[model samples]
Target chain A: MADVVKFDEHPSDTLRAGANFNLAGIDPASTPGYSGDKGAGESLLSELDGKLTQLQEQLFAESRTGGKKRVLLVLQAMDTAGKGGIVNHVMGQMNPQGVQFKAFKAPTPEEQSYDFLWRIEKEVPAAGMVGVFDRSHYEDVLIHRVHRWADAVELDRRYRAINEFEARQTAAGTKIIKVMLHISRDEQQQRLLARLEDPSKRWKYSGNDLKERAFWDDYMDAYQAAFERTSSEHAPWHVIPANKKWYARIAVQQLLLDALNGLALQWPVPEIDVDMERELVRRS
Target chain B: MADVVKFDEHPSDTLRAGANFNLAGIDPASTPGYSGDKGAGESLLSELDGKLTQLQEQLFAESRTGGKKRVLLVLQAMDTAGKGGIVNHVMGQMNPQGVQFKAFKAPTPEEQSYDFLWRIEKEVPAAGMVGVFDRSHYEDVLIHRVHRWADAVELDRRYRAINEFEARQTAAGTKIIKVMLHISRDEQQQRLLARLEDPSKRWKYSGNDLKERAFWDDYMDAYQAAFERTSSEHAPWHVIPANKKWYARIAVQQLLLDALNGLALQWPVPEIDVDMERELVRRS
Candidate 1:
């Protein structure tokens, strides 16, 4: 039987017996997601490409008219939960122009001094641009919850702050897309061990990462609380099962397409008529 | 004959007396670009899908293995040069997990105090994340030059800071990809007019945009100077023609593929053998 995991439950630090088991009907090699119906789980790689292309064209039209729309994508997940893979694979399909990727790291002295959202707001997408944040402002809740760095009152205040901040963005006509990549502990161990074994990848493995891995239960609890408090209709969280990378990417593509499709954009045609074209041609 | 316009000249600002001339072997419908090469001038739409898939797979591998390569995309361009379109269209191809897009707009009060690069530094890609900066620190050179916001000494100081900043990033294993979208003055006028006619795009059309358009020469001078100073082996600029949006996207896509192909990463394999898998399956 598949290991049923809930966000609220404490994470198991050790690899559990059933944690590695694939869900029924899930193929490790094939995509691992279903839309509304199981039978409709068709290959969307092509459709994703087509939809993205159309969206790009629509957005391109917007930019040509200088009416650019900003897109902010936020990805929050647990350690070894395929956040990295999801970023790599999912964004591999984007055109470099319309997209600007900003990964917010540990706050420098300057960043820490200001509000946490200061650094994040700086990286928000400009008009007609898409911005993705690998780990976003929610860190106050996630890391703070696990480490107890912030008191309950402070944390509560932050939760409200985040909701208000995102709401402001939504009002500003910015599209907010958030995803949480979820992976099993057993799968994570397999990945961690693989990184240790490979010389090239060994550089990525740090003792600190392992140390954090030991506190998986605390982190999971933090994540659960953060998600419960933060998830909303304005910024719905897509809990992606990331053991399968292809499916996660396809799902993201679909989500983006759905959002972009709602925009209802028209391409600009040159204002010149047949007579104008002829006259311009004749003059030329 | 094609007008011999200088860098400082805007396509709209210059009114040329000429017949509608279609250069031989040039497909007007094809994305407009002067690669100076006779072949492979197709727009981004033609090749966007294929490259998106290839990159997605690579990103998945890198993310799964916890590789720490960060991809930073920098786009610079004149007004209506398709920067927004490029961001929208190009990013349409990649996975969201690995990519985070940032557009640097007018700095806030807090941002203005520090060096211009300070806000940008905070948004740099983390290990294994892709960061895109739209109208990034280069604005110090581009906009500052046109507006004369910085005296010669301050501008000179800013240039050195930028060079050092990018070099340090490259040394620290950041891959910086810079693209400049080039659009003609005629094309700019056509696009601007479209924005004025469209109510939805009116929000993006500012009186200043028109005023800025009038100072095309100054902007070009600023851009040329900026490009010459900052284009380096570590972060070379690929000048993309923006007349054909499709072509611009294609050029950027090719650049991404080339950069990623250089990494040559392998997907991690499970250490457990088939027998172990079978046993695990049976146990489950």
Candidate 2:
């Protein structure tokens, strides 16, 4: 189960979104592919942390030395689903040099005037980078659909555009991992209440979260439809059970590790005389 | 000395640029504002780390709760001067939510068409956030002048324009900390050679870095001139001796801690009814 957790490239357990997947079919609280004691979770994650960190550095180093490959971890989730925590805890373990994190808030008036992907294209991680999008172009389909902001024809055009975009990135030495953190409505309500209760966390609370919560059913429907339309061979969507924040974090890291390791990454070949450089550093 | 380092807000020690400051004036081997054992440095930083972490989290919390103030930490240096290391070590310690790190590489054709600061203005840390620029607008004067890309009059205009731009941000509730990590020419050569020797670091080696190094003296002259014209009470330029990378990291963190502490920040008042929320969470 542990090896399967680390080595499973297909993400079959959570890759439900595109393959006749149903949002209602998956249990958010259940931990997939692992039946370990909950107390052992942190230690399990720490082990993965070490391996992933090394691979990430190598990915960065390889990219520096003419490795064209890069990875983009596209994260989309509802409020209180722990997107920030995943960034801080999972992506944080990697060196910031190699990680390009862009948090997509509401579109600025300037951004709104451009095509939806205009801002996104500017922010994609460069070669040898592990780029993370806190929210991404997916926002167009999710919120735009929930709010009836897009007409059916325009929405279809966006779906086609997204597929082509990801395909282009894939062909250009990019590996795309799109994940939607799946959390139960009950768990979200509990988390929101918890945030409000703590003085420090109260600041994280937003009235907008509540306003959006009222449209929970509609958002879920939108997500289900989005994955079916946009998910493809190049960049498939994985809906992780997120009520257990640990599971979501661990699973996400495993997915990333698998992606990096799959590249058969090699350290760059030396261009200068190592012995001479060592002597110079020693003298300096 | 430690307290002095933490409290020194003038930035005059490292701000030696223009006609007044010389690249030869300071010792890269020396640890300015610190007298402690080099081995004990991490422990000392660990001590300051606690205070700064709390303050950063509070700044983030406060911002989320409607605090208008934010921080912009601008980092500039020649190649291999450890700009990325500072971001990974110093800024990485803070919560990623509150830290916006942007590495500005050579301008794209699109970026070149617009004025330089347009891209920079877009990336300024939002309210209650801490912004770190890996290489910034200074590149325009530093590289553009070194290469004679801009004529003398145009360079002078860019200096005034940058000053006005930062002054505007200062008036708008942003605390700007502009830092230049200074390394000696000998040290830079040693570091460059070391990168060439190490396969993992080879990818980080850009042929362009060598191209820039060939014009080192011109770049230094450009930097001195820039500081003379642009350093102000609003956004003072700081030059930390970076050969001892740890000392540089600690000092930069100290500068940031000092900036955040100076805000006299308060945790935002509770918006939701605390007791009611507590009761609700307890019920859930």
* Top candidate, metric TM-score: 2
Interface root-mean-square deviation of model 2 in angstroms is 4.1
lDDT of 2: 0.81
| Residue B123 accuracy (lDDT) in model 1 | 86
Model 2 steric clash pairs: A64-B203, A65-B203
Residue-level lDDT of model 2, residues B55-83, one tens digit each, is: 88888777766778888988998889988
* Interface RMSD values for all candidates: 9.2, 4.1
TM-score of each prediction: 0.56, 0.82
Each model's DockQ score: 0.16, 0.29
**Across residues A1-284, which tens digit of lDDT does each residue of candidate 2 receive?**
23222323335444546677787888989787766544456666777777887788888777665788999999999999999889988887777777888889999999999999899899888898999999999999999999999988989999999998899889989999999998988898889888876766777776678778878999999999888998897788889989998778877887887788888887777476567645544544
lDDT of each: 0.63, 0.81
Per-residue CA lDDT of model 1 for A29-118, tens digit only, reads 333334222223324454456567557556755756656466677887766566666555555555655556666666799998998788
